[model samples]
Target: MKRDLGRGGIVVHPYRGYGSRQEVFVMGRVFRQAALGRAIPHHGVLRDVADVVRRIARHGVAGVRVEASLGANRTTATTDRDGFFDIHLPLQTPLPQGLSWHQAELQVSQGDDRMHCHAEVYIPPPETDLLVISDIDDTVMYTGVADRLRMLYRLFVQKAHQRTAFPGVAALYRALHVGADGEARRPILYVSRGPWSIYEMLEAFFQLNCIPVGPILFLREWGLSWRRPWPRRAEDHKHDLITRMLTMMEDLPCVLIGDSGQHDPEVYTRIVKEHPGRVKAIYIRRVDRRPDRERAIERLREEIAHSDCELVLAADSAAMAAHAHAKGLIAQHDLVEVHQACVDEG
Candidate 1:
């Protein structure tokens, strides 16, 4: 079920078979606070409105409550009439070594049909020294939302309702989170520009596709409608977020993975510039063939010219594996590594 946790969030219970296995979506105030009196009308579409209402009805009056076992330890509000709640947890919470894993429990009380859901929040261990910043649209999946033409067509006419993943991106994502040994570990962070509406969709897509779970930070919509186009100055917001995250983990090195479709090159380029010494490398997927996009492409090249961050463009997951092996990102023996490491550990 999906619900708006008022401050600008869309909480998503992304998977089934909970307990020690699943994770829930928890958004931040950057979006929630901004969305306060600025939500666009639902267009009063009966189907869409009904869907939201049904989801809310599933939660009932008790609604949902989230308790993050990290940082200062905070909880969230109950579901509103619009089916929304907001919980603002600090990015870093000082927990004991064994308690590094954050957990959220949802108790839905709608009369006799009550439900209790819980998922482990994959908080990075204190010893974690690796960071993974990723691109959403194509690098993660085959959404192909970066292209203005397809985006226009889908946003206007087709609506391209279903979201799908690229062939092996999920497996690669799993490897990145779990390393050689299989354990419920951390050191992974997913950064994207996808708006609030699809928060649950993105989480569901990743879980269904076998991608490992991680903290997903996305854009705030900033009062824009769902059909609003990507803004011209949007990359700066990502750049700022990256900088803050990097600064928090300044002691560790980060690996940035993105697609050649949008502002990733530019955002990451600025990140490398601001914290050149902290960036380990960068990997970009080749998705578009426009020469005009060369300006953004050049930005990555410019960063590579002066820093230790290696930037490579892959045609697909296979190409990414080959290139990663060649560059020593992972061992050659693990080249065939498929699925998330947690499965192996289980």
Candidate 2:
């Protein structure tokens, strides 16, 4: 029950994980907390550098043994060099009907004490019409991810509640979670290219902004951890993760959301091609205003033409929400909430 192994100087950062019909993945990091919190750097030059140093310093014990059990299934995983452990277990029977997620126990042995905690693993019900997987950077909040200085400033200075979700994203995401009939209660997975160091902060951000939380999946551990795949870090990350979901939940369709500032267009295009009719929609927020970027996304429409997926390049959340409303992907009444949420700065 003690997730933060304070006495043992170890903390397990287990995310609200997700799964399909019979398979559930529960992932978390068991890192060593720094003896004391690092000071916020004063100069701009030190801000970004200091943050990375702090993250790796706090990134705890690697190769630790982990024990996780889901229902009758139990599995063990060793933390990688980055102190991250991802365990996959399969359930023989489907979770109870009408349930969106299930809680499973995970135990980590550190020295004399065996610390443990329960982490939520989402299991989409049979009624789910679509599964939503969204990115968190420029897509969810204004982190200024492309700008290194601004991104470091936001990451170090801003608290989760202080962070803001892109206009109308909360309402738009909520509508998708509830589905078109206003009661389907689908699953929404939040993923990012960033490391697991910000997991707690991201969780608080989701809770504060009212975005439905399913699983927080990340592709790599970022700069400090050179172990991440080189060159293609963002590439095929969304495609690969979604493929796993699609493989497990064969009957359900999927909707992808990300910003044009990154490789979302290309990654999503690959998913649409590889999965065929499983993708319902792809919403890429147009954060990049360059003429070349606009034309680039336009070409993706041609790529996914034959598939049921429609890649919509929109400038704002309102545009995507409008499209979803017109298509009855989200309840019509939810449009007002979407419009209102977009303008709500708080």
TM-score top scorer? 2
What are the lDDT scores of the predictions, listed in order?
Answer: 0.56, 0.78
Q: In candidate 2, which residue ranges exceed 4 Å CA deviation?
A: 1-8, 37-56, 223-232, 343-346
Model 1 spans > 4 angstroms off: 1-94, 104-120, 146-161, 180-184, 225-233, 292-299, 338-346
Candidate 2 lDDT over 172-241, as tens digits, reads: 9989889788888888877787666777678889888888877888886664536742224456667788
Residue-level lDDT of model 1, residues 76-189, one tens digit each, is 545543334444345343444565455555544443544455545564665554677787767776666657677533322322235556667766766666554444254566
